[model samples]
Target: MDLVSTSREALRIGAVSYLNSKPLVHGLTALEGAQVRFDLPSRLADDLSAGRLDVALVPIVEYLRHPEYQLLSSACVACWGPVLSVKLYFRTPPEEVQRLALDEGSRTSAALAQILLAQLHDVRPQLVQLPIGDSIDDVEADAVLLIGDRAMQTSDDQFAEVWDLGDRWCRWTELPFVFAAWVARPDLPVHASQLADVFDSVRDRGVAAIESIVAAEAANLGLEPALVRDYLTRYLHFTLAKREQLGVELFAKHCRELGLVEASRSSLEHSS
Candidate 1:
């Protein structure tokens, strides 16, 4: 069915509130027949699963967990290398880490940290929650995983070692890591293809308007515009092409092996 013609109620869309997601949602508010809400990535996943949202830009791990979810757009939050925004600060060596504090807002990064540690060092640390607004000082773990703006701003001087999960993943696997993607719940009132087009168009426009996004968001995050610009343009990758698809597949495979997510019922095929 054509959503614009048949649905009187606006499509409920959930998006991440982090700076990395701004480009994907830049023009979303102005789109007719859609209502956009911003929240933490994990919260968005929960909302989408509960039927509160028709679609969401959710963490890729969440998408892999839900077999019914459909890939709605090719636009995503990915990194080819050195994502400065998703980091792990280790107070102990990787092999000696006994406990890990995960950012409350993250699911993908948390899972990625575990996967990396387990794969490289054969260490599986006990997991702990690092509540939003809580710092490394508050968590009495061997390591802490932080994502989004806080990850970029937090000092690493107190830590024994730091790892940029994205950079490490790329160096280890030579593949781009997809942090988040636009996914729609099953049985949507609108055509999936149409919705995908809207999302892709919004992403293109947002990427083109990176300068404006930096100018508007940098001050709010207490970061320099130059840093924000480079973070968005240089460090982050938005398109989910062939190599990114391979990354998603590889990530899902590892997640399944680690039992982080169930065995895949279907492949993550994107709408063209």
Candidate 2:
């Protein structure tokens, strides 16, 4: 179907509001016929599943539960190494983590933490869901999983061992880990190619205007602009390519092996 003829109604777009996500969604609202709403990654995934969002920047693991959804091309929140965000803060070694306080904001990161522990440490810790914005200080857990802005706030003084999941995945699998990607529902009327083009264009513009983005985000998050710039430029990867797709598949395989998802067990199919 022709993209122009697909739909004239406003498209409901789900976006992650984190500073790390700004690049992919920058100027997205400027696109014609698009209505953008921002929320946490996990909420976005729920909205996508519940039909509240036509498309969403959702966790990669969300796709395994709904393989019928189409993954948009050339846009992702990924990292080749050392994402500097999405971290596991532990007072003990990875293998000795007895109780874990998990951030409910991102299930993908939570799953990644589990996958890493199981594969690398052979330990299965008890999981406790913790609310966002509140510190894990009150939670009685040996380790805590934090993502997005909170993860960036972590320092060596706070934890005996801080594991950057992106760096760990890269070192362990030698593949870029895709944290999130734009996914469209099977029945959405929008044109996939047109949507992909819109997202890619937004990403390019966002990266080009990194200085302004850095300044704004730094002020908003109370972080140094230089740090923000380094994070955006050095850590986060926006492109979803062949290698990234393979990475997603590998992640799915791990998820399945650990019984994290059921629907993907037979299909093993993912949108490229």
Candidate 3:
């Protein structure tokens, strides 16, 4: 069926357009009763909260922000260490940094940056939101937070210090960090378990098609295919297993301590 026809009857699923997400949603459109659409990570959270999307790959922090939403699948956009994609470029040392320009496409990364800066570095910079494509020169910040494609494309030498939040979190807590997860709204038109099965199947297919996904996305993002493949296979952790669940709980604990989210501890656990 065409998009218009699918939009009305199928479950609306929000897909991220970043290269990191390409593998997760590969061949997802081929799934029946599910209509996939693309949007930024932050927008997906908004759409899901507003009831525009039945399910979405939303920022992990969004799940904490909205406790009513149920995690729909075992697949996630996660990382164990040094995720080259989520970076904080700083011209000044972490403690001296007083201002930060944030990527508008981020919600989880932005909040994670805050948590890290406050607790880890003892710094509380004023955050200013900027478009994802905006240049670092556009705002005079001591540090800048970039996520997704833009973060991947950035060079390390451009900044005095580059802090990968994933690496930092892993080193500090020795646990994987879940950046995004597939979550469904409280009241859905479709059954939650059925949605989970379809999404899990799609995730498996997507992971199996990694080579094709890397080749196609490399051309679009202007990156080397080998590097893209390594990043996908090595850096990006897509499974939400026991350790990943522990990561979510730890992250939620930090978020709660920072007063960033109102969710209870159990809300961080993925619902089967």
Candidate 4:
């Protein structure tokens, strides 16, 4: 068994490589027979699909995109009303906003934003894919959707105002926002216990020791440590309950109606 474990090499697990995700994977050092990998959620999804990872913290919709994928643990890298992180910045009074830039790190948030645009409030902003490191002014459009660490790092003083998508979704639907999640493939390796142990380490070290994470990660991103600490502690959550689950389902239904996803299969249903 020891030889088999040694032969396993590194697990090549995938993560966002962002401040928000560091806590979820902070305990990877303690997991035996497993090595963690980090990248954007899109890259994580692509790698996981291509068999580069045993599991990953993929965007929620990516899991829905391939429903055959399984969730190994209940813990998620999510939040209730992630004010500074998952926000949609608008220059056009929210109603007349025309062109919108879509954050490449996002899949579920982009979809949820569209759902709100079409269903909750009639919006038709031209969604443009803006890659990371692309230069664009906040005044370019009436609205632009931003996600992940970059969104959190963007100060309100830099923009006219920021709308927390998670917070707005809560006010509109009264539920917690389900963002990124951990995923496992259908043919999980026999060393699954080690996988569970890895996640156990993440939940214990990452969630429990958030201040250190916020301090370190905020500094790396050139953001105020205090602001990052406030967001991580007051906004983000790791558990999925009845309402968040329902919100997932609701978003899935809306996506199906918009023809964004194949109707034969539903991607919003996040089941472990």
**RMSD of each candidate relative to the true structure:** 1.5, 2.4, 2.5, 3.1
TM-score of every prediction relative to native: 0.97, 0.93, 0.94, 0.86
Model 3 stretches astray by more than 4 angstroms: 1-8
Native-structure RMSD, model 3:
2.5
lDDT of 1 by residue, 157-262 (tens): 9889999999999999999999999999996778888988888989999999999999999988989899999999999979998999898889999898899997
Model 2 residue pairs with clashes? none
Q: Number of backbone collisions per candidate, in order?
A: 0, 0, 0, 1
Error of 3 at 11 (Å): 1.0
Candidate 1 — what's its lDDT? 0.91
Scanning candidate 3 in windows of ten residues, the lowest lDDT window is: 1-10
Per residue, candidate 3 scores C-alpha lDDT tens digits across 19-101 of: 88876788878866767899999999999999999899989899888868888889899998988889999999888999998
C-alpha-based local distance difference test score of model 2: 0.85
Tens digits of per-residue lDDT, candidate 2, 16-75, equal 999889998888877777778999999999999999999999998998888688877577
Candidate 4 has an lDDT of 0.71
> Which pairs clash in the backbone of model 3?
none
lDDT of each: 0.91, 0.85, 0.85, 0.71
Candidate 1 residue 155 C-alpha distance from true site, Å: 1.1
Off by over 4 Å in 4: 1-9, 138-140, 157-161, 191-194, 263-272
Model 4's TM-score against the true structure? 0.86
Model 4 C-alpha lDDT per residue in residues 51-136, reported as the tens digit of each score: 98878988777766676777666567666665567778766566676788887777888887787777756876787886776644
